[model samples]
Target: MSISPGPSNLYILARTMSDGHRSGVAAAGGMAIGSLIYVLLTALGLAAIFRYSPTAYTVLKLCGAAYLIFLGIQTIRASGAGNTSKPKVRIMGMSKVFKQSIVVELTNPKTALFFLAFLPQFVDPQLGQVALQLVILGLLYAILAFSSDLLVVLLSHNLGKWLSSHPLFIRWQDRVAGAILIGLGSYIAWQEFIQK
Candidate 1:
Protein backbone atom coordinates (compact mmCIF):
# COMPACT_ATOMS: atom_id res chain seq x y z
CA MET A 1 0.00 0.00 0.00
CA SER A 2 2.90 2.34 0.63
CA ILE A 3 4.02 2.16 -2.97
CA SER A 4 0.55 2.23 -4.50
CA PRO A 5 -0.47 4.75 -7.13
CA GLY A 6 -2.69 7.18 -5.25
CA PRO A 7 -3.34 10.86 -4.75
CA SER A 8 -0.27 11.25 -2.55
CA ASN A 9 2.05 9.58 -5.01
CA LEU A 10 0.56 11.43 -7.97
CA TYR A 11 0.85 14.73 -6.16
CA ILE A 12 4.48 14.03 -5.35
CA LEU A 13 5.16 13.16 -8.95
CA ALA A 14 3.45 16.27 -10.26
CA ARG A 15 5.18 18.58 -7.80
CA THR A 16 8.59 17.09 -8.50
CA MET A 17 8.02 17.44 -12.19
CA SER A 18 6.86 21.01 -11.92
CA ASP A 19 9.04 22.38 -9.15
CA GLY A 20 12.13 20.35 -8.21
CA HIS A 21 13.41 17.73 -5.76
CA ARG A 22 13.28 20.08 -2.81
CA SER A 23 9.57 20.71 -3.22
CA GLY A 24 8.87 17.03 -3.76
CA VAL A 25 10.84 16.06 -0.67
CA ALA A 26 8.99 18.72 1.27
CA ALA A 27 5.73 17.18 0.16
CA ALA A 28 6.91 13.72 1.15
CA GLY A 29 7.95 15.01 4.57
CA GLY A 30 4.57 16.67 5.03
CA MET A 31 2.76 13.52 3.97
CA ALA A 32 4.81 11.44 6.42
CA ILE A 33 3.91 13.84 9.16
CA GLY A 34 0.29 13.71 8.11
CA SER A 35 0.36 9.91 8.21
CA LEU A 36 1.99 10.03 11.61
CA ILE A 37 -0.78 12.33 12.79
CA TYR A 38 -3.30 9.78 11.59
CA VAL A 39 -1.35 7.07 13.36
CA LEU A 40 -1.59 9.01 16.60
CA LEU A 41 -5.28 9.62 16.04
CA THR A 42 -5.84 5.96 15.29
CA ALA A 43 -3.94 4.92 18.37
CA LEU A 44 -6.07 7.23 20.49
CA GLY A 45 -9.29 5.91 18.92
CA LEU A 46 -10.07 9.38 17.54
CA ALA A 47 -9.99 8.11 13.97
CA ALA A 48 -13.06 6.00 14.71
CA ILE A 49 -15.06 9.22 14.57
CA PHE A 50 -15.01 8.92 10.81
CA ARG A 51 -16.21 5.33 10.93
CA TYR A 52 -19.18 6.31 13.05
CA SER A 53 -20.01 9.48 11.14
CA PRO A 54 -20.63 9.30 7.42
CA THR A 55 -21.39 13.00 7.20
CA ALA A 56 -17.95 13.97 8.42
CA TYR A 57 -16.28 11.63 5.98
CA THR A 58 -18.32 12.89 3.07
CA VAL A 59 -17.67 16.49 3.95
CA LEU A 60 -13.92 15.94 4.19
CA LYS A 61 -13.86 14.08 0.91
CA LEU A 62 -15.73 16.82 -0.88
CA CYS A 63 -13.56 19.51 0.62
CA GLY A 64 -10.45 17.67 -0.47
CA ALA A 65 -11.84 17.40 -3.98
CA ALA A 66 -12.66 21.06 -4.09
CA TYR A 67 -9.21 22.01 -2.84
CA LEU A 68 -7.53 19.91 -5.48
CA ILE A 69 -9.68 21.42 -8.21
CA PHE A 70 -8.83 24.87 -6.95
CA LEU A 71 -5.11 24.11 -7.00
CA GLY A 72 -5.38 22.67 -10.49
CA ILE A 73 -7.10 25.77 -11.80
CA GLN A 74 -4.47 27.94 -10.17
CA THR A 75 -1.73 25.88 -11.77
CA ILE A 76 -3.28 26.15 -15.20
CA ARG A 77 -3.74 29.88 -14.86
CA ALA A 78 -0.13 30.27 -13.79
CA SER A 79 0.92 28.27 -16.82
CA GLY A 80 -1.12 30.55 -19.07
CA ALA A 81 0.86 33.55 -17.83
CA GLY A 82 4.22 31.90 -18.46
CA ASN A 83 6.59 33.52 -20.97
CA THR A 84 8.22 31.41 -23.67
CA SER A 85 11.63 32.95 -22.92
CA LYS A 86 11.48 31.82 -19.28
CA PRO A 87 9.68 28.76 -18.00
CA LYS A 88 7.22 29.24 -15.17
CA VAL A 89 8.52 26.62 -12.84
CA ARG A 90 8.67 26.67 -9.05
CA ILE A 91 5.80 29.08 -8.63
CA MET A 92 4.91 27.79 -5.16
CA GLY A 93 7.04 27.93 -2.07
CA MET A 94 8.31 24.70 -0.55
CA SER A 95 6.58 25.58 2.72
CA LYS A 96 3.28 26.09 0.93
CA VAL A 97 3.71 22.77 -0.84
CA PHE A 98 4.42 21.08 2.47
CA LYS A 99 1.34 22.53 4.13
CA GLN A 100 -0.85 21.74 1.15
CA SER A 101 0.38 18.14 1.15
CA ILE A 102 -0.54 17.75 4.80
CA VAL A 103 -4.00 19.13 4.14
CA VAL A 104 -4.45 16.78 1.20
CA GLU A 105 -3.34 13.76 3.20
CA LEU A 106 -5.51 14.59 6.17
CA THR A 107 -8.58 15.18 4.03
CA ASN A 108 -8.26 11.73 2.53
CA PRO A 109 -10.81 9.58 4.34
CA LYS A 110 -9.42 6.47 2.75
CA THR A 111 -6.12 6.91 4.62
CA ALA A 112 -7.99 7.26 7.88
CA LEU A 113 -10.09 4.19 7.14
CA PHE A 114 -7.09 2.21 5.99
CA PHE A 115 -5.26 2.78 9.25
CA LEU A 116 -8.39 2.09 11.29
CA ALA A 117 -8.73 -1.28 9.62
CA PHE A 118 -5.17 -2.27 8.76
CA LEU A 119 -3.47 -1.54 12.07
CA PRO A 120 -5.74 -3.62 14.30
CA GLN A 121 -5.13 -6.86 12.45
CA PHE A 122 -1.53 -6.87 13.70
CA VAL A 123 -2.38 -5.80 17.23
CA ASP A 124 -2.32 -8.44 19.96
CA PRO A 125 -4.24 -8.07 23.18
CA GLN A 126 -1.91 -10.53 24.86
CA LEU A 127 1.03 -8.26 24.12
CA GLY A 128 -0.28 -5.58 26.47
CA GLN A 129 -0.24 -1.82 25.70
CA VAL A 130 -2.33 -2.01 22.52
CA ALA A 131 -1.88 1.68 21.86
CA LEU A 132 1.91 1.34 21.88
CA GLN A 133 1.70 -1.49 19.42
CA LEU A 134 -0.50 0.60 17.17
CA VAL A 135 1.93 3.49 17.33
CA ILE A 136 4.88 1.27 16.52
CA LEU A 137 3.08 -0.27 13.61
CA GLY A 138 2.03 3.10 12.37
CA LEU A 139 5.55 4.48 12.68
CA LEU A 140 6.93 1.61 10.67
CA TYR A 141 4.27 2.14 8.04
CA ALA A 142 5.05 5.84 7.87
CA ILE A 143 8.74 5.17 7.47
CA LEU A 144 8.17 2.73 4.67
CA ALA A 145 5.78 5.08 2.98
CA PHE A 146 8.20 7.97 3.20
CA SER A 147 10.93 5.83 1.72
CA SER A 148 8.69 4.93 -1.18
CA ASP A 149 7.68 8.52 -1.75
CA LEU A 150 11.30 9.62 -1.63
CA LEU A 151 12.17 7.19 -4.37
CA VAL A 152 9.32 8.62 -6.45
CA VAL A 153 10.60 12.13 -5.83
CA LEU A 154 14.10 11.24 -6.99
CA LEU A 155 12.93 9.50 -10.15
CA SER A 156 10.40 12.12 -11.08
CA HIS A 157 12.89 14.91 -10.45
CA ASN A 158 15.30 13.26 -12.84
CA LEU A 159 12.63 12.90 -15.47
CA GLY A 160 11.49 16.45 -14.96
CA LYS A 161 15.03 17.73 -15.34
CA TRP A 162 15.33 15.95 -18.67
CA LEU A 163 11.94 17.15 -19.88
CA SER A 164 12.54 20.70 -18.70
CA SER A 165 15.05 21.17 -21.47
CA HIS A 166 12.48 20.97 -24.22
CA PRO A 167 10.54 24.11 -25.19
CA LEU A 168 7.22 22.33 -25.73
CA PHE A 169 7.45 20.40 -22.48
CA ILE A 170 8.32 23.55 -20.56
CA ARG A 171 5.33 25.25 -22.19
CA TRP A 172 2.87 22.50 -21.27
CA GLN A 173 4.31 21.07 -18.07
CA ASP A 174 2.01 23.05 -15.82
CA ARG A 175 -1.04 22.18 -17.88
CA VAL A 176 -0.21 18.50 -17.66
CA ALA A 177 0.34 18.71 -13.93
CA GLY A 178 -2.85 20.72 -13.48
CA ALA A 179 -4.83 18.24 -15.56
CA ILE A 180 -3.56 15.33 -13.48
CA LEU A 181 -4.61 17.03 -10.28
CA ILE A 182 -8.01 17.98 -11.67
CA GLY A 183 -8.56 14.47 -12.95
CA LEU A 184 -7.70 12.93 -9.62
CA GLY A 185 -9.99 15.36 -7.81
CA SER A 186 -12.85 14.74 -10.20
CA TYR A 187 -12.41 10.98 -9.92
CA ILE A 188 -12.52 11.15 -6.13
CA ALA A 189 -15.61 13.39 -6.13
CA TRP A 190 -17.38 11.22 -8.69
CA GLN A 191 -16.61 8.09 -6.71
CA GLU A 192 -17.94 9.60 -3.51
CA PHE A 193 -21.06 10.98 -5.19
CA ILE A 194 -21.88 7.69 -6.88
CA GLN A 195 -21.42 5.77 -3.68
CA LYS A 196 -24.00 7.98 -2.05
Candidate 2:
Protein backbone atom coordinates (compact mmCIF):
# COMPACT_ATOMS: atom_id res chain seq x y z
CA MET A 1 0.00 0.00 0.00
CA SER A 2 1.12 3.50 -0.77
CA ILE A 3 1.50 5.92 2.10
CA SER A 4 0.35 9.51 2.01
CA PRO A 5 2.87 12.29 2.60
CA GLY A 6 2.80 13.42 6.21
CA PRO A 7 4.50 15.86 8.55
CA SER A 8 8.02 15.05 7.47
CA ASN A 9 7.29 15.73 3.85
CA LEU A 10 5.75 19.05 4.70
CA TYR A 11 8.76 19.97 6.78
CA ILE A 12 11.13 19.24 3.96
CA LEU A 13 9.00 21.01 1.37
CA ALA A 14 8.74 24.10 3.52
CA ARG A 15 12.45 24.09 4.19
CA THR A 16 13.41 23.85 0.55
CA MET A 17 10.44 25.62 -1.02
CA SER A 18 12.42 28.81 -1.58
CA ASP A 19 16.16 28.32 -2.03
CA GLY A 20 16.58 27.47 1.65
CA HIS A 21 14.77 30.70 2.59
CA ARG A 22 11.29 30.45 4.06
CA SER A 23 8.26 32.66 3.92
CA GLY A 24 7.08 34.03 7.23
CA VAL A 25 5.07 31.57 9.31
CA ALA A 26 2.47 34.21 9.95
CA ALA A 27 2.25 34.86 6.25
CA ALA A 28 1.71 31.23 5.60
CA GLY A 29 -0.78 31.01 8.41
CA GLY A 30 -2.68 33.95 7.03
CA MET A 31 -2.48 32.39 3.63
CA ALA A 32 -4.49 29.51 5.01
CA ILE A 33 -7.32 31.82 5.87
CA GLY A 34 -6.78 33.73 2.66
CA SER A 35 -7.13 30.59 0.65
CA LEU A 36 -10.35 29.68 2.38
CA ILE A 37 -11.67 33.18 2.03
CA TYR A 38 -10.97 33.32 -1.67
CA VAL A 39 -12.44 29.90 -2.29
CA LEU A 40 -15.56 30.62 -0.31
CA LEU A 41 -16.05 34.05 -1.74
CA THR A 42 -15.50 32.80 -5.23
CA ALA A 43 -18.00 30.04 -4.71
CA LEU A 44 -20.51 32.54 -3.41
CA GLY A 45 -20.32 34.38 -6.75
CA LEU A 46 -18.52 37.33 -5.26
CA ALA A 47 -15.38 36.82 -7.36
CA ALA A 48 -16.73 38.23 -10.58
CA ILE A 49 -14.75 41.42 -10.65
CA PHE A 50 -12.16 39.92 -12.93
CA ARG A 51 -14.27 38.96 -15.94
CA TYR A 52 -16.38 42.00 -16.58
CA SER A 53 -14.45 45.17 -17.09
CA PRO A 54 -11.07 45.85 -18.65
CA THR A 55 -10.46 48.83 -16.40
CA ALA A 56 -11.05 46.92 -13.19
CA TYR A 57 -8.82 44.10 -14.36
CA THR A 58 -6.10 46.56 -15.17
CA VAL A 59 -6.36 48.22 -11.81
CA LEU A 60 -6.17 44.93 -9.96
CA LYS A 61 -3.18 43.79 -11.95
CA LEU A 62 -1.45 47.05 -11.17
CA CYS A 63 -2.17 46.68 -7.48
CA GLY A 64 -0.82 43.16 -7.40
CA ALA A 65 2.22 44.30 -9.30
CA ALA A 66 2.90 47.12 -6.92
CA TYR A 67 2.63 44.89 -3.87
CA LEU A 68 4.99 42.30 -5.28
CA ILE A 69 7.48 44.86 -6.48
CA PHE A 70 7.54 46.56 -3.12
CA LEU A 71 8.23 43.27 -1.42
CA GLY A 72 10.99 42.54 -3.87
CA ILE A 73 12.58 45.90 -3.21
CA GLN A 74 12.38 45.33 0.51
CA THR A 75 14.00 41.94 0.13
CA ILE A 76 16.83 43.51 -1.78
CA ARG A 77 17.24 46.25 0.79
CA ALA A 78 17.34 43.75 3.64
CA SER A 79 19.95 41.66 1.89
CA GLY A 80 22.03 44.71 1.05
CA ALA A 81 21.94 45.85 4.65
CA GLY A 82 22.94 42.36 5.84
CA ASN A 83 20.19 42.25 8.45
CA THR A 84 18.42 38.92 8.41
CA SER A 85 17.99 37.89 12.01
CA LYS A 86 14.43 38.98 12.63
CA PRO A 87 11.32 38.87 10.52
CA LYS A 88 10.77 42.00 8.49
CA VAL A 89 7.73 43.94 9.58
CA ARG A 90 6.05 44.14 6.20
CA ILE A 91 6.00 40.44 5.50
CA MET A 92 5.55 39.06 8.99
CA GLY A 93 2.98 39.27 11.80
CA MET A 94 -0.39 37.58 11.93
CA SER A 95 -2.55 40.62 11.38
CA LYS A 96 -0.55 42.18 8.57
CA VAL A 97 -0.09 38.95 6.74
CA PHE A 98 -3.76 38.15 7.09
CA LYS A 99 -4.77 41.50 5.68
CA GLN A 100 -2.16 41.42 2.96
CA SER A 101 -3.12 37.96 1.82
CA ILE A 102 -6.76 38.84 1.81
CA VAL A 103 -6.15 41.94 -0.25
CA VAL A 104 -3.90 40.13 -2.67
CA GLU A 105 -6.44 37.40 -3.15
CA LEU A 106 -9.37 39.72 -3.43
CA THR A 107 -7.92 42.57 -5.45
CA ASN A 108 -6.80 40.49 -8.38
CA PRO A 109 -9.53 40.42 -10.96
CA LYS A 110 -7.97 37.25 -12.31
CA THR A 111 -8.96 35.43 -9.14
CA ALA A 112 -12.60 36.37 -9.57
CA LEU A 113 -12.58 35.21 -13.16
CA PHE A 114 -10.85 32.05 -12.07
CA PHE A 115 -13.61 31.23 -9.60
CA LEU A 116 -16.33 32.07 -12.07
CA ALA A 117 -15.05 29.53 -14.55
CA PHE A 118 -13.65 26.98 -12.14
CA LEU A 119 -16.49 25.97 -9.80
CA PRO A 120 -19.19 24.52 -11.97
CA GLN A 121 -16.99 22.03 -13.77
CA PHE A 122 -16.98 19.42 -11.03
CA VAL A 123 -19.87 20.55 -8.88
CA ASP A 124 -22.56 17.91 -9.04
CA PRO A 125 -25.78 19.36 -7.66
CA GLN A 126 -27.68 16.13 -8.22
CA LEU A 127 -25.54 14.16 -5.81
CA GLY A 128 -25.88 16.61 -2.92
CA GLN A 129 -25.84 20.25 -1.89
CA VAL A 130 -23.49 22.43 -3.88
CA ALA A 131 -22.38 24.68 -1.03
CA LEU A 132 -21.48 21.72 1.16
CA GLN A 133 -19.41 20.21 -1.59
CA LEU A 134 -17.53 23.48 -2.05
CA VAL A 135 -16.88 23.73 1.64
CA ILE A 136 -15.51 20.21 1.69
CA LEU A 137 -13.11 20.80 -1.15
CA GLY A 138 -12.07 24.21 0.11
CA LEU A 139 -11.46 22.84 3.60
CA LEU A 140 -9.22 20.15 2.23
CA TYR A 141 -7.14 22.70 0.37
CA ALA A 142 -6.86 24.92 3.44
CA ILE A 143 -5.72 22.03 5.64
CA LEU A 144 -3.03 21.14 3.16
CA ALA A 145 -1.84 24.75 3.00
CA PHE A 146 -1.77 25.14 6.77
CA SER A 147 0.30 22.03 7.05
CA SER A 148 2.72 23.38 4.47
CA ASP A 149 3.23 26.61 6.45
CA LEU A 150 3.83 24.73 9.68
CA LEU A 151 6.45 22.76 7.85
CA VAL A 152 8.02 26.04 6.70
CA VAL A 153 8.27 27.20 10.29
CA LEU A 154 9.86 24.00 11.54
CA LEU A 155 12.29 23.30 8.72
CA SER A 156 13.58 26.82 8.25
CA HIS A 157 14.04 27.47 11.94
CA ASN A 158 17.78 26.86 11.63
CA LEU A 159 18.47 26.88 7.93
CA GLY A 160 17.31 30.45 7.50
CA LYS A 161 20.22 31.77 9.54
CA TRP A 162 22.74 29.88 7.49
CA LEU A 163 21.23 30.88 4.17
CA SER A 164 20.66 34.50 5.15
CA SER A 165 24.22 34.86 6.35
CA HIS A 166 25.60 34.02 2.96
CA PRO A 167 26.04 37.11 0.81
CA LEU A 168 25.31 35.43 -2.49
CA PHE A 169 22.13 33.80 -1.24
CA ILE A 170 20.78 37.07 0.13
CA ARG A 171 21.47 39.08 -2.98
CA TRP A 172 20.26 36.32 -5.20
CA GLN A 173 17.12 35.81 -3.23
CA ASP A 174 16.32 39.49 -3.33
CA ARG A 175 17.06 39.90 -6.99
CA VAL A 176 15.10 36.87 -8.08
CA ALA A 177 12.14 37.58 -5.90
CA GLY A 178 12.16 41.17 -7.04
CA ALA A 179 12.43 40.30 -10.68
CA ILE A 180 9.51 37.95 -10.40
CA LEU A 181 7.32 40.63 -8.90
CA ILE A 182 8.32 43.22 -11.48
CA GLY A 183 7.71 40.77 -14.23
CA LEU A 184 4.26 39.94 -12.99
CA GLY A 185 3.42 43.59 -12.72
CA SER A 186 4.71 44.37 -16.19
CA TYR A 187 2.90 41.46 -17.70
CA ILE A 188 -0.39 42.38 -16.16
CA ALA A 189 -0.01 46.00 -17.10
CA TRP A 190 0.91 45.08 -20.61
CA GLN A 191 -2.06 42.80 -20.95
CA GLU A 192 -4.33 45.49 -19.75
CA PHE A 193 -2.93 48.19 -21.98
CA ILE A 194 -2.43 46.25 -25.18
CA GLN A 195 -5.28 43.77 -25.04
CA LYS A 196 -7.88 46.37 -24.40
Candidate 3:
Protein backbone atom coordinates (compact mmCIF):
# COMPACT_ATOMS: atom_id res chain seq x y z
CA MET A 1 0.00 0.00 0.00
CA SER A 2 1.23 3.48 -0.85
CA ILE A 3 1.61 5.81 2.07
CA SER A 4 0.09 9.23 1.92
CA PRO A 5 2.23 12.26 2.71
CA GLY A 6 1.14 13.68 6.04
CA PRO A 7 2.52 15.82 8.85
CA SER A 8 4.50 12.80 10.01
CA ASN A 9 6.55 12.74 6.81
CA LEU A 10 7.32 16.47 6.79
CA TYR A 11 10.48 16.16 8.84
CA ILE A 12 12.01 13.51 6.64
CA LEU A 13 10.78 15.02 3.43
CA ALA A 14 12.12 18.42 4.32
CA ARG A 15 15.51 17.06 5.23
CA THR A 16 15.59 15.10 1.98
CA MET A 17 14.94 18.19 -0.07
CA SER A 18 18.12 19.84 1.16
CA ASP A 19 21.20 19.92 -1.06
CA GLY A 20 23.34 16.75 -1.02
CA HIS A 21 21.07 15.24 1.61
CA ARG A 22 18.56 13.93 -0.94
CA SER A 23 20.68 10.94 -1.81
CA GLY A 24 20.67 9.66 1.73
CA VAL A 25 16.98 10.42 2.01
CA ALA A 26 16.39 8.60 -1.22
CA ALA A 27 18.55 5.72 -0.03
CA ALA A 28 16.89 5.56 3.36
CA GLY A 29 13.51 5.70 1.70
CA GLY A 30 14.36 2.81 -0.53
CA MET A 31 15.79 0.81 2.33
CA ALA A 32 12.74 1.49 4.43
CA ILE A 33 10.31 0.12 1.86
CA GLY A 34 12.52 -2.89 1.26
CA SER A 35 12.42 -3.83 4.92
CA LEU A 36 8.70 -3.36 5.03
CA ILE A 37 8.37 -5.80 2.16
CA TYR A 38 10.33 -8.43 4.05
CA VAL A 39 8.26 -7.95 7.19
CA LEU A 40 5.17 -8.06 5.06
CA LEU A 41 6.37 -11.27 3.49
CA THR A 42 7.10 -12.72 6.90
CA ALA A 43 3.74 -11.67 8.22
CA LEU A 44 2.10 -13.37 5.28
CA GLY A 45 3.99 -16.63 6.07
CA LEU A 46 6.30 -16.55 3.05
CA ALA A 47 9.27 -16.62 5.38
CA ALA A 48 9.00 -20.34 4.60
CA ILE A 49 11.62 -19.76 1.95
CA PHE A 50 14.11 -19.19 4.71
CA ARG A 51 12.65 -21.88 6.94
CA TYR A 52 12.73 -24.84 4.56
CA SER A 53 16.16 -24.28 3.13
CA PRO A 54 19.62 -24.30 4.63
CA THR A 55 21.15 -22.85 1.50
CA ALA A 56 18.68 -19.98 1.61
CA TYR A 57 20.60 -17.92 4.09
CA THR A 58 23.78 -18.79 2.25
CA VAL A 59 22.60 -17.21 -0.94
CA LEU A 60 21.03 -14.41 1.02
CA LYS A 61 24.34 -13.82 2.74
CA LEU A 62 26.21 -13.81 -0.51
CA CYS A 63 23.75 -11.40 -2.08
CA GLY A 64 24.08 -9.15 0.92
CA ALA A 65 27.86 -9.54 0.87
CA ALA A 66 27.96 -8.69 -2.78
CA TYR A 67 25.80 -5.62 -2.29
CA LEU A 68 27.72 -4.23 0.67
CA ILE A 69 31.09 -5.09 -0.75
CA PHE A 70 30.00 -3.40 -3.94
CA LEU A 71 29.09 -0.29 -1.99
CA GLY A 72 32.39 -0.43 -0.14
CA ILE A 73 34.29 -0.80 -3.38
CA GLN A 74 32.39 2.06 -4.94
CA THR A 75 32.99 4.32 -1.95
CA ILE A 76 36.68 3.59 -1.91
CA ARG A 77 36.91 4.10 -5.64
CA ALA A 78 34.98 7.34 -5.53
CA SER A 79 37.16 8.59 -2.71
CA GLY A 80 40.22 8.02 -4.82
CA ALA A 81 38.79 10.07 -7.68
CA GLY A 82 37.99 13.14 -5.52
CA ASN A 83 34.49 14.39 -4.84
CA THR A 84 31.71 14.99 -7.32
CA SER A 85 29.57 18.12 -7.30
CA LYS A 86 26.29 16.28 -7.71
CA PRO A 87 24.92 13.68 -5.35
CA LYS A 88 23.97 10.33 -6.83
CA VAL A 89 20.36 9.51 -7.43
CA ARG A 90 19.04 6.43 -9.17
CA ILE A 91 15.89 7.06 -11.14
CA MET A 92 13.33 4.37 -10.54
CA GLY A 93 9.80 5.11 -9.58
CA MET A 94 9.40 2.03 -7.40
CA SER A 95 12.34 -0.30 -7.88
CA LYS A 96 14.86 2.12 -6.42
CA VAL A 97 12.92 2.44 -3.21
CA PHE A 98 12.09 -1.26 -3.07
CA LYS A 99 15.57 -2.58 -3.74
CA GLN A 100 17.45 -0.16 -1.51
CA SER A 101 15.03 -0.60 1.35
CA ILE A 102 15.49 -4.36 1.20
CA VAL A 103 19.27 -3.98 1.17
CA VAL A 104 19.14 -1.77 4.24
CA GLU A 105 16.69 -4.05 5.98
CA LEU A 106 18.83 -7.07 5.28
CA THR A 107 21.98 -5.21 6.27
CA ASN A 108 22.49 -8.03 8.79
CA PRO A 109 20.92 -11.06 10.33
CA LYS A 110 20.43 -9.00 13.46
CA THR A 111 18.18 -6.64 11.55
CA ALA A 112 15.98 -9.54 10.53
CA LEU A 113 15.82 -10.80 14.08
CA PHE A 114 15.20 -7.24 15.17
CA PHE A 115 12.13 -7.08 13.01
CA LEU A 116 10.95 -10.46 14.26
CA ALA A 117 11.58 -9.71 17.91
CA PHE A 118 10.46 -6.14 18.08
CA LEU A 119 7.58 -6.07 15.63
CA PRO A 120 5.50 -8.51 17.62
CA GLN A 121 5.54 -6.20 20.59
CA PHE A 122 3.48 -3.73 18.65
CA VAL A 123 1.58 -6.15 16.48
CA ASP A 124 -1.45 -7.64 18.13
CA PRO A 125 -3.07 -10.45 16.20
CA GLN A 126 -6.33 -9.20 17.55
CA LEU A 127 -5.88 -6.14 15.42
CA GLY A 128 -7.54 -6.31 12.07
CA GLN A 129 -5.05 -6.56 9.20
CA VAL A 130 -1.99 -7.21 11.29
CA ALA A 131 0.13 -7.16 8.18
CA LEU A 132 -1.11 -3.70 7.31
CA GLN A 133 -0.45 -2.58 10.84
CA LEU A 134 3.08 -3.90 10.61
CA VAL A 135 3.51 -2.03 7.38
CA ILE A 136 2.40 1.19 9.06
CA LEU A 137 4.72 0.65 12.00
CA GLY A 138 7.52 -0.17 9.64
CA LEU A 139 6.85 3.06 7.73
CA LEU A 140 6.82 5.00 10.99
CA TYR A 141 10.17 3.56 11.96
CA ALA A 142 11.46 4.39 8.49
CA ILE A 143 10.32 7.96 8.90
CA LEU A 144 12.14 8.26 12.20
CA ALA A 145 15.26 6.50 11.01
CA PHE A 146 15.43 8.52 7.81
CA SER A 147 14.81 11.74 9.68
CA SER A 148 17.87 11.09 11.83
CA ASP A 149 20.04 9.87 8.99
CA LEU A 150 19.07 12.70 6.71
CA LEU A 151 20.13 15.17 9.33
CA VAL A 152 23.49 13.49 9.31
CA VAL A 153 23.49 13.45 5.55
CA LEU A 154 22.70 17.15 5.45
CA LEU A 155 25.61 17.83 7.75
CA SER A 156 27.97 15.44 6.06
CA HIS A 157 27.15 16.46 2.54
CA ASN A 158 28.55 19.88 3.30
CA LEU A 159 31.30 18.36 5.39
CA GLY A 160 32.27 16.15 2.47
CA LYS A 161 32.54 19.21 0.28
CA TRP A 162 34.54 21.26 2.76
CA LEU A 163 36.87 18.45 3.81
CA SER A 164 37.68 17.30 0.30
CA SER A 165 38.51 20.85 -0.76
CA HIS A 166 40.79 21.41 2.21
CA PRO A 167 44.28 19.98 2.59
CA LEU A 168 43.81 18.68 6.13
CA PHE A 169 40.45 16.98 5.80
CA ILE A 170 41.06 15.83 2.25
CA ARG A 171 38.90 12.83 1.41
CA TRP A 172 38.03 12.18 5.02
CA GLN A 173 34.31 11.78 4.40
CA ASP A 174 34.87 9.25 1.65
CA ARG A 175 37.21 7.21 3.78
CA VAL A 176 34.79 7.30 6.70
CA ALA A 177 31.69 6.33 4.74
CA GLY A 178 33.63 3.72 2.78
CA ALA A 179 35.23 2.20 5.84
CA ILE A 180 31.96 2.11 7.70
CA LEU A 181 30.19 0.37 4.84
CA ILE A 182 33.01 -2.14 4.51
CA GLY A 183 32.92 -2.81 8.23
CA LEU A 184 29.16 -3.26 8.18
CA GLY A 185 29.41 -5.68 5.28
CA SER A 186 32.06 -7.72 7.05
CA TYR A 187 30.00 -7.73 10.22
CA ILE A 188 26.96 -8.99 8.37
CA ALA A 189 29.00 -11.68 6.67
CA TRP A 190 30.40 -12.79 10.00
CA GLN A 191 26.93 -12.98 11.50
CA GLU A 192 25.71 -15.15 8.64
CA PHE A 193 28.49 -17.65 9.20
CA ILE A 194 28.61 -17.66 13.02
CA GLN A 195 24.86 -17.84 13.39
CA LYS A 196 24.85 -20.96 11.29
- Give me the candidate number with maximum lDDT: 1
lDDT of 2 at 169: 65
Where in model 2 is the C-alpha error above 4 Å? 1-23, 47-58, 77-80, 83-94, 108-114, 148-159, 171-176, 191-195
At residue 135, what lDDT does model 1 achieve? 94
Candidate 3 clashing pairs?
30-101, 31-100, 31-101, 34-101, 34-102
Q: Rank the candidates by lDDT, best first.
A: 1, 3, 2
Query: What RMSD, rounded to one decimal, does every model reach?
Result: 1.5, 6.7, 7.3
Write candidate 2's Cα lDDT for 1-196 as tens digits: 0013322222223223233333446545555666677678756755455456656656766776666556546545544553555443333344654465555545444444444456546679898877777777667766775676566556665665566667566546555555554555566567666876
In candidate 2, what residue range of length 10 has the lowest lDDT sum?
1-10
Query: Tens digit of lDDT per residue, candidate 3, span 1-196?
Result: 1233311122223223322455556655665565666677667754556657757757766666666666655656656544345443322334443365456456444445445556657878887887788777776765665566555556656655565456434434455555666666676677677977
Which candidate, 2 or 3, would have the higher lDDT against the true structure?
A: 3
lDDT of candidate 2 at residue 17, scale 0 to 100: 29
Give lDDT for model 1: 0.86
Give me candidate 2's TM-score against the actual structure.
0.62
Clashing pairs in 2: none
lDDT of each model, Cα atoms only? 0.86, 0.53, 0.54
